[model samples]
Target chain A: MLFHVLLLITFIIVILIYEWKHYQGRDRYVFVMLFALASIYLLAAIVDWRIPEYVQGVDFLLSPLKKPLQAWLDQFQI
Target chain B: MEQKISSIQFTVLVFMNTLGTAIIFIPTIATRYGRENGWITVIFATLLGMVFILWLTTLIGQEDDTNFFKIMDNRVGKLISYCLILLMVSFIFFTTFANIWSIAQFVSLQILMGTPPQVLALISTFTGLIAVRYGLEVIVRSAEIFFPFTMLSLTLLALLVWPEAQLIRVQPVMQLNQAATFVGVLPVIALTYMELIVMLVVLPHVNDLRQAKKAFLIGGGLAGFCIIIVTFAAIAVLGVDGTVRHAYSIYVLGQNIQIAEFFERIEVLVAFIWFITIFFKVSTCFYFLSIALQHMLKVKNYHSLTVPLGMILLATAMTNLPNIFYDFEMMNSTYLILSYITGLTVATVLSLAMLIRKYKEKVK
Candidate 1:
């Protein structure tokens, strides 16, 4: 995991360097955003975080509606 | 956005895009709930998905040739537009992540049992990144070349496997568990149709925007039709119980081909079709992600982010999703709703809001 994290960071640095010239003007924001996103992913992977859990909140919120939705659709099943 | 694709390319790209991982899973997932009536869900989902594509095109129609992000920015304010962009970006990225994971799982399980999942995930994402790096034109053109092979392979497989199908397997005709059948509709729609959201991104890049409607219908309809055939084939060939028992019903279906004594083991050809379709799917998602991020961050070029995004996708694909069971649960339930409702609600609201604003201006 640690090796993977290092590898990801190394790739990000190479990309940053390769695209450094394009970072002029508003493109700098993309540079920053890409760097930050890649870093977060690297960090998350290293920590072995179950990243799906972060997105599962939406799943939980929508769970209550599934049954009712299913019941309603069942009416036409016959 | 300087490059543009013709309607034919757009249509073919749509077919490839919609074909994604659903081909592998829908047979089992749909039949598990809808039983012998699983094919019915395909027809229903296609019709309903047609309505959705119509509604989406109408939304795009209101904006002339403006891209989705700008349309959103204009309809809702900047902040809300940014929020929607985040939602869309996450949605597309998550999709790419999921597909990478899925293909990795599929390859490791079926094709290369000895390969590490992480290696497979990287290879899958890398192929997509290469296409994305060249821009949408490369992706669409490659789809043009790949689309025929995809369809031809599917046809050949169907022909080869048709003889093995026991029509009796699809027995007890309309005895579907209504609730399960209806609940079944969500995943099929989510898996196949909701992906039309990518159309919104690609539309502005289309050469003749007027052909968007026709392109969408033919492409989406054909893609849905393919799924229907696959579902029917799986049920007829494997039956509901057998279909549900296998992780990849389509892959298993391919394994059933026993022509002459020498014509066995044709799954390699089938795997090729799966590879290109999933590759295009991931590339399409990755394309949209880069474009959306460029717009959101006010970047000038989208290309530079491709490598970074690919890296993120690799990491996420490797570690983000839980085990196969959890992944399946999410796809059938939460993801089905989240992908469909969130997209439909947002697009409808934005379109209606745009229409209302037009009316107010006319009144004034």
Candidate 2:
């Protein structure tokens, strides 16, 4: 957990320093967006969120097709 | 913007990209359904992949120095082009996640038993970041050098395992379970072969667009043939039941290679060759992430985003995938198939619309 926080802080500092050196005007917007995303993800990781369960688009969306495939594979007594 | 790769380099990149972590698990995955005839499923999937590659290369080759997004923008306008870009980005992200996460899992399980998976995932992404920093041409050139060495190791492993390969293990070859075999092809198609769509990003970078058509065909064909050989070796050496029982049957196949009482423990070499393959795979995904984001944002330099994006990939791989079972579930499910087909279909539809518009413009 502490490692995640340290990594996030280091990432933000690095990006900020990079932006300061390069200092392209609108490019800061991209950096800001990136930093925000990294924070959310890193914090989420630290929180031990059920991340995979939410992205269950794979499960919910494709559940219909899954059963048929399971049934087919089960028929072969390997 | 300066396209530097020749036809040969493009071909090698395609071969290396197609040969990703699939090489590690396709034997087990396919054998689970097709039994002794599992290799046949791989061949069928490869053939299907070839058709898609030909269609893809021809679609992009029609316009000079063009890519998938540019073509979409030309035909469908910027609004829909952005939407399609998002879809492609998601597909690429999911792909990179699957490959890197699987590598982390395998390394932690097979070799580095003490290391945390997140650290392994980060380390793998770091290697990819270095390649992405060097740019696409460097990655392609590196593949050109590494491709031969990887292939030689694979070939040596094959020869060493040949004596243990009992033909009797695959005796009931003709009688195949049609439904299971078809189901087996789904993962190979969704996870492995359909990844040739990376060509849509790469084709525009080739020096000769004309050569790209042939390059992709040959590359996809060669890659398919190589995968078939790996699958055949796995089934023959381990038998259908044995192969299906293990998660990574190819690595197990390597463990049986006890030649001259000296050339044992060749799984180390197999792992190294797969490392090269996965490195190229992750590098290609990182390159796609950088360039695609640059194009989407209309930024001057994608290189600036490479490291930051690599950081996201590492985090996502750590957080997004909980275990190897989830990875297997993703592969064996239809979710990836549906997603990949949707992206390919949209790209193809948009491209076809562009071609029609072009023809109509010319006629007018």
Candidate 3:
């Protein structure tokens, strides 16, 4: 946990130093977005929050078709 | 000045990327559905994959210095191209996370039982981050360096394990349900070649366009051959039941290797092949994500984004993909479907669009 926190801090520092050193007008928003994503990830880790698995979402979307897909695939089963 | 890699380096990257997680997981999955006929399924998948690669190279066309994004933009216009690029980026990101999580999971379970997965995931992500920071030239060159040793080790493992291979175990060949063998090809294709659509991003970076296409085919073909050999060896040595029983069947095959009562229990040492290949896989995916993000964000340099992106990947790998079982379930189901949709479907659509545009111009 401490290691994760320290790692997150180090990442934040690196982001800041990188943006400072390679300050480009177009990349400012990109860095800001990255920083926001990093902060959210850190907060989730600290809170021990279960990030919703993207696969689950995909599974949910495909659930209705799962049986049909299986049945279709089964037709090929000799 | 733009960085470029030679065709040989590109081939090595393709080889490593195709082997990626497939090396660890292919034998089990192939044997599960195809049974003793599993190796045949892999061969079938490779043939299909070759067709897919040929199509992809055609879509990339005669351009010496263009990427998938540029091709899509030229054919389909900005809005549609952006949409497709975003989808490709999402797919690339998912793969990067998957590779990171897989290596971490393997290390935690097999080697460092006490280490937290997050730490392993961070280490994997950091390695990729460092590679990405140096750019494509370094990444491909490193892959080139590691390619020979990884292949040699794999070849040695194959040769040493040959003594244990019982032809009787692989008997009754091609007698399995033909449908099942065909069905087995989907996952193998999805995991190996379809996942390789990420390479299209780096295709423009290869110095020789024509040779790079040939390299692509050769690399993918070689990797497929490796998988086929490993799958056959597992079946011949461990039999179908034993192959499907373990999560990492190739590792189990390594465990079965005994040479002159001296080289015993060398699975850990044999695992070096996977470590090197997976590192290249993760790094390649990470590099793709950085490139995709740079294009999406109009960033001047991709270097600045790798650290934060790596952090996010670490967190995601830690938070999601709770265990190997979940990953297996995902891989067998949703990931397979997603691969087809994002990989084949998208590439086919882009290729058709390019054809229509060309036809229209010719008519004009």
Query: Per-model C-alpha lDDT, please?
Result: 0.80, 0.78, 0.83
List ranges where model 3 is wrong by over 4 Å: A70-78
- Comparing 1 with 2 on DockQ, the higher-scoring candidate is 2
Which pairs clash in model 1?
A: none
lDDT of 2 by residue, B1-364 (tens): 6657889999999888888877888888888878888998898888888887777766664565445567668767898778777767777887887788899899999999989877888889989999988888999999999988988988887788899999988767757576677667777877676776666787888888888789988887887888899999999999998898888888998899897898787898779878999999999988888888888887677766776687677777877778877777677665465556655776577667767877999999
Model 1 scores a TM of: 0.92
The TM-score-based order of candidates, best leading, equals 3, 2, 1
Query: lDDT tens string, model 1, B7-81?
Result: 999999889888888888888778877888888877788888888887777766545544678877877789877
Give TM per candidate: 0.92, 0.93, 0.95
**What interface RMSD does every candidate have?**
4.0, 3.0, 3.2
Chain A vs native chain A, TM-score per candidate: 0.63, 0.64, 0.64
Candidate 3's error at B117, in angstroms?
1.8
Clash statistics: count for each candidate: 0, 0, 0
Write the residue-wise lDDT of candidate 1 on A2-24 in tens digits. 77778767876776777777667
Native-to-model Cα distance after best TM-score fit, residue A68 in candidate 3, in Å? 3.4
Output the number of the DockQ-best candidate.
3
Candidate number of the best TM-score: 3
Measured over all alpha carbons after superposition, the RMSD of each candidate to the real structure, in angstroms, is 2.8, 2.3, 2.1
**Which sections of candidate 1 miss by over 4 Å?**
A1-10, A46-53, A60-78, B62-66, B176-179
